[model samples]
Target chain A: MQRYKGIVAYDGSGFSGYQIQPNGRTVQEEIEKALGKMHKGKPVSIVASGRTDAGVHAKRQVIHFDSALQLPSERWVKAVNGLLPGDISVMQVDAVSSDFHARFDASGKTYKYVVYTGSIRDPFKRHYAAHYPYKIDIAKVKKASEFLTGTHDFTSFCSAKTEMEKKVRTVTNISIEQNTDEIVFTFTGNGFLYNMVRIMVGTMLDVGTGKIELQTIPSILTGRDRTLAGKTAPAEGLYLWEVYY
Target chain B: MQRYKGIVAYDGSGFSGYQIQPNGRTVQEEIEKALGKMHKGKPVSIVASGRTDAGVHAKRQVIHFDSALQLPSERWVKAVNGLLPGDISVMQVDAVSSDFHARFDASGKTYKYVVYTGSIRDPFKRHYAAHYPYKIDIAKVKKASEFLTGTHDFTSFCSAKTEMEKKVRTVTNISIEQNTDEIVFTFTGNGFLYNMVRIMVGTMLDVGTGKIELQTIPSILTGRDRTLAGKTAPAEGLYLWEVYY
Candidate 1:
């Protein structure tokens, strides 16, 4: 058996999440189904770099799977994409060492949260961004993001429901980018907790709108309390932009 | 009663064109229904800059209507937008002279046709662009476009069904702009005949692909025959970008 590595891109609008659930359609389930069909009804399993919440898009999600069927790497890319849904495509495929694990390999990840400040929802951008419909001070948002960079216990930015007890994560960098109709916040880190990026974005937006002070982020991180931070931003605005391996 | 002028924007994917049709849902029908509902079943009429074919989008389509209800321009914008569907919106509203006509008073218009040049369809841009999965030489497109600018009979570029005897129109400018994943062709002209832009784009794309010679453009324009040009480009790629008064 040979292991294959592939890069996946998905719209995420119709998917429940990346992982397979008992009752809902998901990104993982769709790809596995496609692989099984390619192998003539034999079951296929895949391991992904990580899970993305419902409505969260991904530009390049890494995945790995082992198969006994022999096919050229380029053929594997074409054959699997043809069997998959329109919203998901295998961007690239290659053979890899059996020891190379998609999730366990050393790497970092980057995410972007897009927010539109327009009063009325833009027809073209409604599906792509989170509409805030409020005044935001860009200076405040940039200042708040500075405090989030570096190693820290990100309990204040993580989802309360996650079973993981370790909340420490390293944030390599953070940036707030301004566009004509939207402001995007990009976060790069070694790892992220559940809902961590969205929570951090919501907290920064609160700072921008003066709901939370610029100085509030440092203290919130120090306190290690989820309730001390701002709301969890909507999942639709989040994108798993890249994963490094 | 006062005459009101407005600039409308729509996504066009859910529309059956801008005109009122008996069968399919049209953009005009939706706005008229909204106006009728606002006026308590009193039918309200609207005149547009021009009719866009089914699946064609608009960025600033000019329109005018008379209203017995007096409200501030801002309120009119909000109330109309609230009543309209998510795909359509009144981007701007203003008071205009009673003699002002959206179609007759217009001097020129600008249209943009977008074509994506990628092997795989971009899921995010599927609704917004036309997928052309072929190699297009940029230099050939630009050279062909240069001959299309300026005044011409334009009978070769127009649809065959138009009853108007005068096929002569002045094209002020034509530009081929290149983007990373898409190529946009912008046209500015005093007026256009039915399907004029799409037919022209099809002809130019053919020239770009080497199916037609660059020197043939002049003879085709001189022929002034609909059959002399290339196929009609798809409607979804066409956008009425701006209406000039």
Candidate 2:
């Protein structure tokens, strides 16, 4: 069997989540079903960089799977895309080393959280961005983001449901950019625990809005308590942007 | 009673069309329902600049309604928006003269059609853009658009189901802009017949793809036959951008 790497983009609104579940539709289930059809009823499995929550979109999510069939990269993309639904697309495909693992071999990941600060919520962006009607100081948001950058034990910034024993992850960069009424928070890190990016964005928003003091960021990080942080942001605003190997 | 002019925006995916019908949800029905609730089920009606086909979005659709209760502009916007669904938004509200009419007082209108030329369909843009995979010459599109601009009898570029008696309309501008994988065709005109913008876009795309010769644009206009033009573009890619007073 030859391993193939593929890049996928999906609108996560219609999906329950990225992982396979017994009751609801999932991205993994759809993709595996498409691949299985190509394999002539033989089930095929896929490994993603990580699972994304329901309503969390992906710009370029990476995945790897083993296939017995031989095909060119372009044909693989077209053939698989033809089988997939309109909400999920297979963008690019390439044969990879059999030893390469999609989840374990990943070096880093980048995520973006979109915040709509408009006085009125835009209908088109309702499913893509979190609406924050309160006024926020951009400078305070920037200052708080600085405290989030770099390696730290992000226990306070991770969901309590995370199964990982080690809560430590290195955040390589945190950048905040404002485009008109939308504030985009980009986070680049070596690794992220469950809901880490959403938690960080939530805390920073609180800091920007003066609900949480900027100076309290250090304590929040050091406390290592989930309750000490701000509320978890909505899943619709988050996007799994890229995976680097 | 005071006439209130409102600017609205909507994601047309869930809506049947801009007008109210016997079945299926519509933007007009939702707005009137919201206003009816505010007026204690008195059933308020609104008149839009024009009707858009099913799956056609609206960036700034202008509408006017008469209400007996007097209220501030912002309050009107907030009250209506609070009652409306997430897919529709009330952008602005202003008190206008009793003589003012949304349909009759409009001097011009602008519509935009989005075309996605990417190799792979983008999942996020599936509902917002029309996918045209073939390579096309932008210069050819621009040249064809020039012939379509200004005063012309656009019978060939109109739907066969149109009930309008006059096929003449002044197309003030037709600008083609390419942004990466998307081509946006913006058309400004005094008025448009049924499916005029979509038909024009379809014909221009054919010219760009060499399916139709550039010199035949004049004949298509002179022939005044719907069969002489290209196919009508999909409704999902068309947007009512603005209505000018």
Candidate 3:
């Protein structure tokens, strides 16, 4: 069997999450089902770079799987996409070394969170962006994000449900871009715990709106308490942008 | 009684059309239903600039209705939007003259059609753009659009289902904007017949792909034969952008 790596994109609006569960539909289930068809009733499992929560979209999620089929790269993409739902797409595929892994070899990840600040809600963007009705100070938001950059323990910015033992992660970058009525926050890090990005955004929003002191982020990180941070931002606004190997 | 003019936008994916129908839900029905609720079960009607076919979106559709309530403009927008579905939004509302009409007083309208030319299909844009797999010549499309500008008898570019007595209309502007993997065709005209903009776009696409001669647009307009033009483009790519008074 040959191992193959692929880049996939999904809308995530209809998916329960990226991982398979007992009842709810998932991105992994749909992709595996499609692969099973290609394998003629033989089940094929896939390993993703990581799991995304429900309603979290991905622009270029990486995955790997083993297959006996000897199809070309484009043919694999076409065959798999033909069987997949319209909300999920297989963008490209390439043969990789047999030992290459999607999850283990990953070096870093980039995620983007979109916030819509329009007073008038936009229907087209309802599913894509998190609507923030309150006025935000961009200068304060920028100042607070500086405390989040670089290596730090992100325990306070992680969900209580996270089972990972390592609460420490290296955040290499945090950038904020503001347009007319939208603010996009981009984060690049070695790894993120469950709901880390969303929790960070929520905490930053608190600082941006002057609810929390700007200098409190460092204390919150050292506090290592989930309750000390702000609420977890909604899943719909978060996007897994890319994975580095 | 007071007259209110409102600007509304809708995703149109879940809507059957903009007009009321027997079985399928429509934008008009949703708005009227909201108005009925606000008026305490008293039936209310609305007049739109025109009706869009099933799956056609609208960025700024104008409508006028008569009501006895004297709420502020923002209140009207918020109240109606609260009752409407997530796909439909009332952006703004204003009190207008009782004699003003949404359909009769319209002087011109603008429509936009988006075509996606990416080799890999995008799931997020599947419902918002028409995917044309073939390579297109944008220069040819621009040249053909020039012939379609100004006054002309556009019967060949209109649907045979039209019941209007006169098919003569003046197309004031036809602009084409091409980006990395998509093309947007914007048409501004005094009026359009049934499926006029879609048919015109379809014909231009044929010319763009060398399926039809570039110079034949004039003859197609003058011939007034529906069969001479290309097929009507899909409705999902079309958007009613604006209606001017």
Of the candidates shown, which would achieve the greatest DockQ relative to the real structure?
2
> What ordering of candidates by DockQ runs from best to worst?
2, 3, 1
TM-score for predicted model 3 compared with the true structure: 0.98
Candidate 1 per-residue lDDT over residues B39-69, each given as its tens digit = 9999999999999988899989999999988
Between candidates 1 and 2, the one scoring higher on TM-score is 2
Candidate number that wins on DockQ, 1 or 3: 3
- Please name the candidate that would achieve the greatest TM-score relative to the true structure: 2
Residue runs of model 2 more than 4 Å from their true location after superposition: none
lDDT of 2: 0.95
lDDT of 3 by residue, B180-231 (tens): 9999999999999999999999999999999999988899989999999998
**Candidate 1 chain A lowest-lDDT run of ten:** A119-128
Q: Give the least accurate 10-residue stretch of model 3 chain A, judged by summed lDDT.
A: A118-127
lDDT of 1: 0.89
lDDT string for model 3 (A123-188, tens) is 888879998978999999999889999888888989887888888999899999999999999999
* Superposed model 1: Cα runs more than 4 Å off: A22-25, A69-73, B22-24
Q: What would the per-residue lDDT of candidate 2 be over residues B1-245, giving only the tens digit for each residue? A: 99999999999999999999999999999999999999999999999999987899999999999999899888988999999999999999899999999999999999999999998989999999999988999999999999999999999999888888899999999998998899999999999999999999999999999999999999999999999999999988999999999
